[model samples]
Target: MSTKPQFGADIETHHTRFDVDRYEDIYVVGDVHGSLDALKRLISRLELNNDDLVIFVGDLVRKGPDSPGVVDFVRADPCLVSVRGNNEQKILRGDKDPDWLREGDREYFESLPIAISFDTVLVVHGGVDPERSLEDHATDELLTMRSPHGDGYDGPFWYDDYDGPHRVFFGHTVHDRPVEREHAVGLDTGCVYGGELTAYDYRNDEFRTVASKTHQDRASSKVVDPA
Candidate 1:
């Protein structure tokens, strides 16, 4: 488990990593995007033990039905934790809160760290810059980065050239399937847009996914290059 000083008011502040251990299995999940039913089904399939931990890459709200429900489920469950995604940041920083937001949801989002760390892996909502030390990464890159070159819709991606100290598991960029690289594993399968809700079992190195019901039909296809 992580110590205190996990979440900070400033993004540039280095986040405290969860040095988690003693779990039967560690499941790293992609963006749920408020697909609560799909998330439930995926959890049911895992048959997780009490000690088994699930770390979500974030985007637990917006773009689908049941955003409030998704937040409530994760908040109630002790085994589940998450990083803060761009969507969550939007809600916290926006002038207007969404109607679906309930009491205590903001605190939950605020509690999420920018990254979760295992001995050899790091989990973030979006990609990290391989060229910089983890402590030096900016908040915007950790939340919304897609291309390594710039915020463009074309390659090469952030992980394409990574030769890492720790393998990074991330989401935010939707792919038809998980992106597998030596140093990066992308699990955002676009669940809100009719793709599968995906999760990676870290101990087993296996992917557990469930078919998702489409809530938003626009841009439902795989993102080869960003759109």
Candidate 2:
């Protein structure tokens, strides 16, 4: 494991690379959005073992109840890791601050990577910059980007244009279901909006989802103002 750091907008962008074995049961989860109960249920369904590793695509906080509980849960677990999401970046950039975050929780958020690479799969909160290589990708873009525009093509999502040697597993843009392209996958199924929290198991090439336990009215309001 090794990390490269880049600073943008007063936040540090940490990128990590991992060399994972083929047999390892690696799982990538979509945006959690502070749905701790849903997250727990989703994890339980995985039946994870000592060898299994789970990586969250981010937005672990904000827009649901028990943001602190989510942070604390992941923090205490060694097998879980996260990439920085737009929501996490927002808090870092001073857009909003919830009372749930503890001092250590803030540090944990700051330490999260902008991207995580394992084997041939790259995990990020948002889609990548098509114009730049992974190493040169901008930190802000990694956290907040939804789509990329280029060469008179005015209206297509980022995954539509992706031609990659590495399979990208990302979360950010909400879709009716998990969007799957040849080279990329969009896993943000709007878990905070009374939708399901999803997870992909790379080893088995499977997807698992747990339906939201939150009320739509309350969840919608929290999506706008997480504080």
Candidate 3:
């Protein structure tokens, strides 16, 4: 499934192209769950080197099998940067406190920055919220927020049909056409949920996607009935 989406770019050139040179390297990925194989393959395909920058949308663990693997790669890779995903946030905040999980994963997440922003784009697990200031949101706001506020539009951690500008890019909403809102783009693409994982070239508005290998709606649901 391929989708060429845009935010406030010229409607005439919406499908054609836009002046996306505002960024340095590719804006890269928004979020990736435990799809380690897919993530590795994607990075290889992109030819990611020391120069390029990768921004993860969040949710690096909790439902997928390679949660630990993903964390290790992100932490070690200098080019790969990530905001807190909902699952990561929950784990860091001691949400479920599952004893079966690894302590390193929890510590890694707890140590992550709240959000990532740039002159040309903004990145997060949820996205930015206009209702409140940046400091108004707690760490959990960096993840787990759905569309339409907490009940509607909370800010920072959400994606939906909201309209504005500033190109608020984020993930968390498994959506159609990356769900363009204001000046934002959502690339969560539902990678771990049997959907494609997409990475956008924030530099020129380009994108690369990696297909799922099996039916995994949750992190641990990699089994495809032996098909």
Candidate 4:
């Protein structure tokens, strides 16, 4: 692993890009939220290989038990990549740092990219701006955005207005089920709230989900917060 400085709000100026053609299978996962057991079960089902790429939509910590375990598991393998989520940004921004996070964890989170592009798919922790190109996307919108409209602009979900050719796969907004739109797909099935942990196979356009085995008491909290 490379040692990089812990970035602050200016982290958006640095981004990482990857070429999908370099891997055989590319799997994108939704908000993990520290459900290590669920994530393990889901990975077991995938039967991943050396050439496979597992990209997490982030929120790897907070709101659930075993956050450190999740971080360790992902960091142990080079095939796994995670985009920074709002919860991660909160931690990186010194908003919330759980006891589980240890030394060097901040650097790891700071080094994470805001979004990842693979072929025609763009994976992010949150939805992107419909009006801006991926390279010009605002870091705030990519990390914390929920609905599509803002500032008194009423409209449909962000994906509904997406006219880009690249399909956007994201997490952040929890749904009872995965939300599928024309150019976007939401996989944050609220795993931290006792919902399913979802993963999308970009190679086959298929989805796999593992029901939450822990934190069932938090199920009711999965509902979207009122705007």
Q: Pick the candidate with the highest TM-score.
A: 1
* lDDT-best of 2 and 3: 2
Off by over 4 Å in 3: 1-24, 98-100, 130-135, 148-165, 218-227
Off by over 4 Å in 4: 1-13, 151-155, 214-227
Where is the poorest 10-residue window by lDDT in model 1?
1-10
**Residue 66 lDDT in model 2?**
77
lDDT of 1 by residue, 156-189 (tens): 7888878776788899988888988888999998
C-alpha lDDT values of all predictions: 0.83, 0.77, 0.61, 0.78
Better of 1 and 4 by TM-score: 1
What overall lDDT, based on C-alpha atoms, would model 3 receive against the true structure? 0.61
* Better candidate by TM-score, 3 or 4: 4
Ranking according to TM-score, highest score first: 1, 4, 2, 3
Q: By TM-score, how accurate is candidate 3?
A: 0.73
Model 2, runs deviating above 4 Å: 1-13, 150-155, 215-227
Tens-digit per-residue lDDT, 1-227, candidate 3: 21223223221121122233433475558457777888888888777666677877777665556877888888888778776777776775567675547757666776665555554355667755555444455545545455425633233333334344445567776653455444667787767777777888765667788886543645333211110
Report the alpha-carbon TM-score of model 4 versus the true structure: 0.85
Summarize candidate 4's per-residue lDDT along 117-181 as a digit string, tens digits: 76557777888777765555567788866654662213345766776666778888777788777
Q: For every model in order, what is the number of clashing pairs?
A: 0, 0, 19, 0
